[model samples]
Target: MTDSSRPTRIKVIRKSMKASPDQTESLLWGDCLFCTDAAMTDYDWVLVYDEFPRTPVGTIRNETEPLLCPPDQTILITVEPPSIKIYSRAYTSQFGTVLTTHSIRDLPHPGHTLGRGCLEWLYIKPMQEILDQKEFPKTKMLSTICSAKQHTHTMHKKRYDLTRYLADRLPELDWFGHGIREIENKTVAMDDYKYHLCVENHLEPHHWTEKLSDAFVAMTLPFYAGDPLATECFPQESFIPIPLDNPQKALEIIRKAMEDGEYEKRLPAIREARRLVLEKYNMFAQTAAVIHNHRETGTIRPGAMLKGRHVLRKNPLHALRELTDTLAYKIRSRGRRGTGTGA
Candidate 1:
């Protein structure tokens, strides 16, 4: 068939087959529909899942398409990795076209290279009223529940213990956990604290964990430790990033700020920072815009392609080698040489 005439396949997650007694037969279908770009074109759209369908009973190839799918009823593409080679052979022989491959990480359109989703919640309310109360302390520190994958058990224990230690050292200070419940409370608690510590575990290139966003959502000043690109993702003045080489100094500054109440008058500016996030990164609106753009354009553009050609021309290999040598030199120099974090 000509490319234009070829059938388009949209991949959707299958739901349970057991009909619900409360609904009409037509309405009783069990499937969660999260729209994907798979069926927008004549090209086959594959839904690759790490887990088996909870309701369907069959090998990936034998699975039947659900009656509730879009009217087009294009082919259902499924593959189990590790055994992906077998599925690949079956797909090529049966469909006469190679299945387009994409990683799950590739799903969320690469938002602004500034990393639009880097902040947790777009809106954080001002806590100035709460901070004005005599009972509420002016000093506070914020951190999140450490994920096991991101930190060693020992590191998690140390950080948690350190939180308690800081709390004990400053009885007037409050310690907030990184939970959905706590994030909800940030609208109030953030007003009282002078500093929010975004102590992330990993430091990957161009990858800053969601903790930075958590801090932003709280509408408090952030003392951060993450990828240097963290600053690129948000306005530079929005955060006070802790240099990897001068962690101790960063901590000291936070301690002093809390002790002296330097952050009290700065609350207005902090609230302004939070407002900027809401204006730029409304999640629902952004998601809808992405979906609409993909539908209109047919294909979502890759994020890496957004970088300037001059940036691509730079020698990453040489930079890596230089970075490795610099790291070695720092390790060897130890306390003797002054070191700084790179942006």
Candidate 2:
């Protein structure tokens, strides 16, 4: 969809105070109609409740605040997740029984709908152009930053050791783990390398961590070790998946690619794919599209609501409040103890 067609009259409403660190109060809950300022006048919908409480109101009651433009004028898009427990409370409370949640995979049909969905990470950087300008070398056996935690793993250590053995066998093969100054530095250095080794311990397959994104952003081919579906989620043919069955075989394949210059011939295609992701899969555009779709269709999907349990005890706000109360009690008790000692 063209940028101009996207929703321009968006409004956010929230309780006057800030909510969670990740949530903006204005995006959660507030009254759009209450604002008289011209700058706030053009909003098409109002977001209610920045963060869903642990226990929301039991039912969708009329008394609950509406987060939208007056009745028919604009759409009322409620940002909710797919969890039945959360939705049950939200549906029973203020926003009414009708609700819809969407997933990141679901794009809007018409392209002008209003709603919200999970905005997954999409790294943006001019990797190809930079790589082209720098004229980076093509070398085998490239190792991107290995986190301290991964280095500590017995399996990971064994894999690294095996890779080191392979590197020793081939003199031309070079390994680099110099600390990267920034994303650009990493991207440029990665583009020069024949194959980027992206090994991670995260459970979710096809998940693109920032490091993997760096590979794509820099127009460098990746030998991914996590999530078999990682290639399916992003630009096709941009990455070479490290086989789960035989990771050593995958390394052998990478070794061949390095020696044969197959990695060099595919650079143009990888560069084009990276460009498409940058233009189409941007977080801002994706977020706006989800917001638009939700308002048009009042249905919530599995991923629309907040994921996992909202552990109240571990909450930062709760922890801070508890700490303050404990300190205050200790101070008061100390004063009383001093008074008793004197008496």
Please name the candidate that would achieve the greatest lDDT relative to the true structure. Answer: 2
Off by over 4 Å in 2: 1-141, 151-185, 188-191, 203-206, 231-236, 244-247, 296-343
* Model 1 C-alpha lDDT per residue in residues 75-112, reported as the tens digit of each score: 22222111111122222222211122212221112221
lDDT at position 69, candidate 2: 40
User: Considering summed lDDT, which 10 consecutive residues are worst modelled in model 2?
Assistant: 28-37
- TM-scores, all models, native as reference: 0.44, 0.46
Clashes of each: 3, 36
Judge candidate 1 against the unseen true structure and give its global Cα lDDT, from 0 to 1.
0.38
